[model samples]
Target: MGKTTNALENVFELAYNGKDYAGALGRVKAFHREVAESLAAGAGPYMMADVNEGFRDAFEALEAQLATVSALRDYDEQYDQVVSYGELLASAFVAHVLNDLRPTRWLDCRPLLRTDENWREGLVDWQATEESLRSEVLPRFQEVQTIVTQGFVGGTADGRTTTLGREGSDYTAAILAYCLRAESVTIWKDVAGLLNADPKTFPDTVRYPEISYRETIEMAYYGASVIHPKTLKPLADRNIPLRVKSFLDPAAEGTLIHDCQHPPLAPAFIRKTDQCLLSFSSKDFSFISEENLAVIFGALAQAKLKINVMQNSAISFSVCVDFSERRVHQLLDLLREQFTLHYNTGLTLFTIKNYDAASVARLTEGRRLLLEQRTRGTFQFVCQ
Candidate 1:
């Protein structure tokens, strides 16, 4: 859905921001036509029949709705345009899927998923979304039997578009399962299952046949790309299991996250690259205390910069976070006058869960560590 989502966002950008509805329509036609053409050339997803025929028909109808420039005069209307375009794309894709598997129904969660009240732009309103799912979606869900809704996209009370955070699809699944009180949630991936380390990064990666929710949450929090960070909480809250299975070998026994009795798991390695280590010290040469920490945390929350790994010394508090230029600059602006700051970019944060001395030594052997923190179950380090 990445490519599809990009196409939809491009349409929104060109039409709403650029104020070029005709150009937006042109891009929609171009990109979707290319997709349809590539599918004809046998380049797209596995389709049994000419799925493009259905998509093309539905997409043409969507194309017809793009020229409603007068309808997008206000902010709310502009948000509607963004969301409507996204829904139209979803509808078109669902129609395409319907062609592939006939007689199977598709459910659209319109009255859709939503965001929290204060930050209406894209942050999900978990309470409202789940509540709406029970009331508006459940009855429709029962009749449809199967659902294929778009992820990352939601709505607001004022009928405006909102998005969940990036890579929010897995979170979407978790939300749906929690609301529905589903038996289990299965996420089919390209790998065997949940691995102790990303196979691409570590050739000796070990798969977890069974993992606990607590362990899985720690892994995801430490920057495991296999699942979204926010995904496990909802599933864990209801004591629901999550399965990570390979799409290639669906029958193969895959990793399961649940409260089951299993042997001690292997050390899990999680690495986050493009990090920036921010160190702040008081100008007055004061020790790092509760008051100082509070000010730093407040600035971080305001800037929305998550500390991947953090440590404090007598005189300084240091944090390693993802290097977002905009957010970092904003944080610097908020705290520059109060404290002296030093930051190093282009760093990597490596977290080893259930680690041993050997694993810690192996990672630190070649690199010069910028910061290191070791706890009972986890060890984290940042290095250039």
Candidate 2:
């Protein structure tokens, strides 16, 4: 997301999970109206949709081509075109607003984060990506500019639509900052900044003025909604600093994430509700060895089942995993031939980062805790 007109410096972007696209789009519209009004004093200057009428033809062509492809990888090009609609919408809207106020640039991010054909989670080939950004991207648009672009999406080597993982727009910003070596990257989120815990859950939560990148990564892993897990890896790899600030109050200095030596904050409580835990064992009491685990895990990977925790013994294997419609059913069908499978759904997974005795109690106090595991900085529990 960026400003509508040539006020080139007001670029606001957000990394959001498409899960809430409806709500997100509403936010986009509101922001566009605000930017439009700020720059031009009236909304008439901005065009609602700058698809240029050619958009329909382009979409139809892409759709026709997509209808013919069977393999998932084969649809990369078409996917890129389809998912990029949102970006085009943003850029188009912004450009329309700027048609009079100022000259604005609508940026396409695919050229910057080019990757191999992994489709949805396109594996970014960093060296090539860096070179492309430095050579083609940075030198051209590095100047102070108001650029409107899409996030959570990218293009592939063969020119296909490849989305970064869900909630990937943040990663997109980091990559952009790293490639351009921007002074800093600020993620304009709806909230004030990173809080010690979710304010809704922990009434006493306080915002951390600043936190190290390592801590942010940990929070992301524990299901902290503030930042996407994928968003941190690239920035951390390059040691680039990141800030999460509220779009409403752009002047307020929000939480800063970088390498620092401050004492780590208290354990952060994170809860992922509505999970499923499965327990399995061979009907004939067959030994569960490396080979058996390998076969099971192979199937799991093929189905894209993300396992959170696992514990196995000679006769039985018990594991905690996320609930995915495809993988869960596939795994059960496969295992039923050799083992008796039982699973419990509608369970809650609570993770306390940097756990202490008090933190553990606070998370599991009244819950029917099922499975608990604690380490120096983290404690995970399966609660019903």
Candidate 3:
């Protein structure tokens, strides 16, 4: 889990479950103290006074904010305003580390209204964000080579802090690159490069030396964990190449995603774990017509449930989504009156792009499949 999740879990364990907000805050304060102490053991040229001061300031501010809270959400905005504040505190620690290393300017992109959408998850407001960045952030880059800032967070014009969805740092980088019109954007990862399959799951995964933007998008959309389609969109639009480099081995060439052509190779294997397959049958023996589909889609949209894959028959429709207990139940509540519902949970959705018979067989060999769909270039199956 990421830092934001870890911090929230700490609060959730105490404040939500244990009903001890003071205990949670105490644990956080002690943790911050330990961190400051450990860093001081080897404070060479770095200003230990500044680090100590920064930590104390942040601790006091966070304690004051959390002191007023009972649960995560009392009377604030949606997406749990209190939790979002904790998220910002988590990200600010990263900025603190950067500032300690060098003369870096730290900023919260959220308060600047760098991205739009008041929801917890956000998308770029290109015109407004670009203007904001060009005015605020760009000038600082001219003064200093490196500036540290928050990712996964932006704000609406009203200054309600919003976030670019989870794992949104890449999207944040893309936004910065697009606004700055940089030469390229590179994401440093643990992996050697972009691979056809997750190395941990598949033993013999192969890396693509270079790939096109479209292929990257397809892989990301299906289940590939390398780069998100959201991150690629802005970069692709600008024709800016993205390099997936290895932080462990900087000498490695890694993979490059640019405007280039390459021969088709092995089928890419993507596995999305913890999926739910829901089948909706008409109360009457009616075909799953456009009207039925429209109703189903609208309900799903209203519930904020994204359909990963779907199929339709004469009298029923089936769709796959990430299994969230609350959201799934909410969707079912909305549609139960219209259609008979049956669902399978704890499933894995396996997608194979540019698939072949061998690849499909290897994945579905021993599994009891819930749903399967195939097309010319893609094959997908949901299995428990």
Candidate 4:
């Protein structure tokens, strides 16, 4: 869930099972009013009245939805409906504020970006989306100097809300840039730039001034938290450069990712926590053959489980994947008919790109290593 959705859920919790919905509703209205007042104080009132009316309508619509929902559960329909308000509220606030400075237009992106019915992690319909953008968004861009729209949210054909995935705002930006044929896409972050390791986790992290798209994609694949994993493909395919800039110090050069060579660099450290290690063996005490591997991989794809690291012997095959109880159970149910399964949860998968012996030792020094795999350029460890 997005930050705004989490906050709204907290508000709902405080409201005592919707008995005090007015309190939460009043808070939202007051916040919108405060933002409008702050913007109106500096600029002349050209569209303030209209923007305020729009905000009121939006809030009322949200309130009506909240009144209808009795409880919050894990169902996809209710989950998507509740969490999508985060982006909507954020875009609305930004649009109203920007309109005060100049003639800016607020665009609801749900109508423009079309996707499948997968509510939580929607699959984009590229043909329908591109057509809608050409017909609907391009004309508005020509008319207005600035347009604000919600990210991470799209609409199905029948007009139901859906989200791309968690932390998908970067993917949303990339999608817009690809459709617009943009010169470049800049993602603003709190850090100075893309660092070799997460500064919060490791000390003395070094920032990369520039990196190639392939290297960036590899880093993202290994669980780099700085950029969303799905964000690099579209930009790379179109040969669009992506700049990671600091929002705090905007003047800094930050890091640029383009189609160019990356100089020899230090080892990059990536850590993915809360992992599960699953091992499979043939029930008849036979070798894990090609056919068995094919069935296992197919089931993994069906369950939407990504294997971060894997190793196989003549009799057993072990793999590390992100831990999700529901999905793990789903995968196990499908595989149990043929293979015996054993799993260990609460593990951490660490990856080092361009690693040396010293760096490898540093990571595994005091940890209980469960699995290890190494290649010419990369090394991975699953540790407890």
Scanning candidate 4 in windows of ten residues, the lowest lDDT window is 9-18
Report the candidate with higher lDDT, 3 versus 4: 4
- Model 4 clash pairs are none
Error of 1 at 374 (Å): 0.3
Across 1-384, the per-residue lDDT of candidate 3 in tens digits comes to 135445654664455343766766666667767766666556644546756777777667655555555545522234334455554554555555666667677677775545555365665678888888888987887776676676666787877667676567788888889987989998989999999999999999999999999989889889788786588888889999999999999999999998888999689999999999999999988888999999999999877788999999999999999887768898999999999999989899999999999999998899998889999899999988
How high is the lDDT of residue 311 in model 4? Answer: 93
lDDT digits (tens) for residues 57-114 of candidate 2: 4335533543443333333344444445545555555555665466566666776678
Better of 1 and 3 by lDDT: 3
For each candidate in the order shown, give its overall lDDT on alpha carbons. 0.76, 0.68, 0.78, 0.83
TM-score of each: 0.81, 0.79, 0.89, 0.86
Ranking by TM-score: 3, 4, 1, 2
Highest lDDT, which number?
4
- The 10-residue segment of model 1 with minimum total lDDT is 75-84
**Model 4 error, position 163 (Å):** 1.3
lDDT tens digits, residue span 1-384, model 4: 124665665555544354776766576657766765665565555566755676677777777766656556434555566567778877876777776667788888887888898767888888788888778777886778898888888889988888887678888888888887889999999899989999889998999999999899999989998898888999998999999999999999999999998678889999999999999999998999999999999999878788999899998999999998878999999999999999999999999998999999899899989999999999999998
* Candidate 4, residue 114: how far the Cα is off, in Å: 1.7
Best by TM-score: 3
